[model samples]
Target: MISVKNISKTFKLYQSPSDRLKEIILHRSYHRVFQALNNVSFEVKQGETLGIIGENGAGKSTILKILTGILMPDRGSVNIDGKITGLLELGTGFNAEFSGLDNIFHNATYLGLSRNDIEKKLDEIIEFTELHEFINEPIKTYSSGMVMRLAFSVAIHADPNAFVVDEALSVGDAYFQQKCMQKIKAFKNNGGSIIFVSHDSNAVKILCDEAILLEGGNVVQQADPETIINTYNFLIAKRSKGEDIRYQGDDTSSGYGNYMVRIDDVSLQDENNNPSEILISGRPAKIVIRLAGEETIDDLTVGIGIRDKFGQDIYGTNSFHLKKKICIKKGQILLIEYYFKEFNVGPGKYTVSVALHTGDTHVNECFHWLDKSVAFEVVAGGDDIFIGFVRLKPDFHIKSETGNKDD
Candidate 1:
């Protein structure tokens, strides 16, 4: 078990040269401070995988550093009940001049293993890393990913009581990534607590049971994986649209309220303004949602989910923040519109459904299933010229250093 209480971190960064010299020579501080974590607190039980997610500067890495004892927190305390082994940075504990064999032993010792203890697991670590040929080479010659693989191999081979992993695991190739997942799974099954940090939503869903969302140096929401990811996606959409947003789930202790809002109709149209189920791949497509608002609907948010034929949600969007509330009088019809940048969805029979939820609480209420909404066929053109999702207009130019002979 781990308990974090009012943990905060701030760094004083010098902007001006005079300030830096004054702080060094006269012991006078003249630097602006940046706050990374502000009164952030959370707990993780034994054998539980807790995920930390947020935007680029949301203090995710700062919290991990504090937890691992790599950086001391400016305020608050982290009460860890067990020994922690962190995989924060690639080659963080490695000496570039040392051979892989020597580096592994050194790093393992730093992780609290003695020489004799690490020698027993040396063969296993080399095998796990699959670096048989390069095991004796100097770490300075190794690629970034190779160093990561070897470092990870040594860290997990010792089997600490707790593991803290950042987004560094993606450094390895797909095959080695799968191996890392298996090792983490084994660690969890053996009652080890884990704190995983990643920006990949699918990774969070696959790995964590509970998660915490942080934004602007504040703990926004902490809940189940599904709920956390839903809130995260909504935040991403809101931020992309240049809006200030805050969303919280309904208080569970207040009991059940069955105020439902369901999607009544979904239709697709092309540029010609004709009803068409089949949409072209490299064109424009529009999704229209017709909903009958039940009860007094205040600030109703609508989301359109576009999935592949196999039911994996590729991308989605919604009116996460409009600055103005979409209050629907009881029994009033509401039309919600979602326009795609371009119809870049590959040729396939895709299904479209709408979700109506409260703006404050990103909780889904009514379920609308349009099994076979539209069948779209992409008319292909250009040989491998356009790639993935939307296609952008590009300009190519050629400049001549020498003018024409006549000139």
Candidate 2:
């Protein structure tokens, strides 16, 4: 098992090397302190995976380096029982001028594997990487993907009791990445402890049983993988806009529209009628919307679209699209509901947006419209499974035709 107790690290920023000498001569401070970690704490339990997620300067890499014994913390302590291996900062242990095969032995030994251990796993590592002829060439001549394959193969074959990885899977081709994920899954199933640090939220949600969110050198939230990832996205959205998105009910929703009609309330619910910002994939999606006509409504059409985090349209339909025009006078109220029996969409964060407009010609003449009025998420579940934003289940069977003479 691997554990970190209130670990923290800080660095001194100096203008130049002369500043250090001047400070020593003057017997006073000449640099500013920057805290990269602030009393952070977490642990990786045996037979489980713990995911650490954050932005570039959120101290995630610092934690990983500490776990791998590459860096020491100025404060706090780290506890470990068995050997720990890490796949971090790819291409670090490799000599640019050395051949791939030579680097394999060099790096694996650097990771604490004995010559016998290396010999036992050497063939499997080379075959898994599939570098074949290129394995004899200098690492500097290999592509970024080949380097990843080699580094990852060496790290995994070391077969430590505990492992630490920092975005190591975000390399190579899609097939190779999947292969890595499968290997990680096997490791987990075999009772090996893992500390996975990555920005790929979907992978975190799928692989990690527990997760932690970090911000500005502090522990923001730590809980189930889905909730932590959602909180991280919310924090990112706030940072991206230079403002905090106001949340009325634990959901960060924001939008704008015209001056005529107004969207009063919007929510996403399951078939049980329980409201939540999360929807299970392949389950029913029940959407409810209430609108109020603030001004006179004339020649108007209203539309609703479920979009992914990128604002790409996932599913959309409108009263106008169905030829069901909504004509209401000023001060009137409107209530609308949509039910989807099988919301077979893949896992992802989604938002429901609404728009009120007029004219059949070009969708101009806007009355009121709110983009991303209600934000929600879709999680994985159900039968045939795969990756991507959309899910289409396929059937498989073999049919046979018997001869006319026999039955």
lDDT against the true structure, per candidate, is: 0.74, 0.79
Give lDDT tens digits, candidate 1, residues 168-226. 89788899989999999999999998999998776776788789999978899998765
lDDT (tens digit, per residue) of candidate 2 on 213-301: 98988999898776676567555544543442432223454443345677788888886879988888888888888878888877667
| C-alpha TM-score for every candidate | 0.66, 0.69
RMSD in Å for all candidates = 12.2, 8.4
Q: How many clashing residue pairs appear in each of the predictions shown?
A: 0, 0
Please state the error at residue 297 of candidate 2 in Å. 17
